[model samples]
Target: MKTTSIRELKHDTTAVMAMVANGESVEIRRRNVPVAVISPIPAKSPIERPNFRGRLKEIYGDALLTVTGTDLISEDRGDR
Candidate 1:
């Protein structure tokens, strides 16, 4: 939790908002008494996860390769 004066909030709105954006609750104060509290809004939408396994299967078709990716890259960049 963080505390900020209303005058400070008005003067430095961007910095104050940045704190809220980074998931910190802020207590707004007037005359040294807390008047309002602000917090980051919960993410509303479902997360979109990537289909990595499907993509790999599509690219390779169940055939296991002999070489590691690192070895393949090293072979490609030989004496470079």
Candidate 2:
């Protein structure tokens, strides 16, 4: 972190912004007292989340079939 007075910040705004752009934090001061700070926003991940169901079907060759809960229970009960 670097400290700069308000007067200096106003005069050297471009330089202060450059420091922030390069990932450095700049503390602004008023008459030698801390007042504000400037920093860069963190980078976000570029990866997109994949559709897992689609991926599963793709890898397993679309073996999925629809079956209801009642159907499952009847199948389990059998001739009992």
Candidate 3:
């Protein structure tokens, strides 16, 4: 971790960014107190749709349908 003042960061924006690009984490301080951090962007995983029903089954088993009684869409629509 590298510590830098806000003024230094402002003065040497490219250099600070270079350090971050090199995978170094920077601690930015304001008035001698730590205020923020700059770090390298993480590699992203392939996006996938979350399985909401599977997650609900894992958490509540068969009780989910029984507990909710009505489908979420119907419940949200009320007595239309």
Candidate 4:
């Protein structure tokens, strides 16, 4: 971690950024009191969409299909 005053940060913006880029956290101070922190942004990971069908199969096997009778669909549609 590195500490920099607000005035120093404003004067040497590039240097502060360089420190952060090297995976160092920076603490910004105002009037000698800490105000904010600057750190490197983490890389994002690939997102995976939820597989509802596979989840249902794992939870209930083949019984999920027939557990809710055909009338459930008709009852849900009636609410609309």
| Candidate with more favorable, higher TM-score: 1 or 4 | 1
Against the true structure, whose TM-score is highest? 2
Residue pairs with backbone overlap in model 2: none
lDDT of 3 by residue, 1-80 (tens): 99999999989999999999999999999998999999999979999999999998999888735545467778889898
Q: Candidate 1, after superposition: displacement of residue 20 in Å? A: 0.4
lDDT of 4 at 73: 78
Better of 1 and 4 by lDDT: 1
Task: Give lDDT tens digits, candidate 1, residues 1-80.
Answer: 99999999999999999999999999999999999999999889988999999999999899998889999999999998
Worst 10 residues of 1 by lDDT: 38-47
Ranking, TM-score, top scorer first: 2, 1, 4, 3
| Model 4, residue pairs in steric clash | none
The parts of candidate 2 lying over 4 Å away from their true place are: 51-80
Clashing pairs for predicted structure model 1, backbone only: none
| Per-candidate local distance difference test | 0.96, 0.89, 0.92, 0.91
Rank all candidate structures by their lDDT, best first, as comma-separated numbers: 1, 3, 4, 2
- Residue-level error in angstroms, candidate 4, position 76: 38
Candidate 2 per-residue lDDT over residues 1-80, each given as its tens digit: 98888888889899999999999999998978889998899999899978998888888785755887899999999999
Question: Which candidate number would show the highest lDDT if scored against the true structure?
Answer: 1
Q: List TM-score per model, in order.
A: 0.56, 0.62, 0.54, 0.55
Candidate 1 Cα errors over 4 Å, as ranges: 45-80
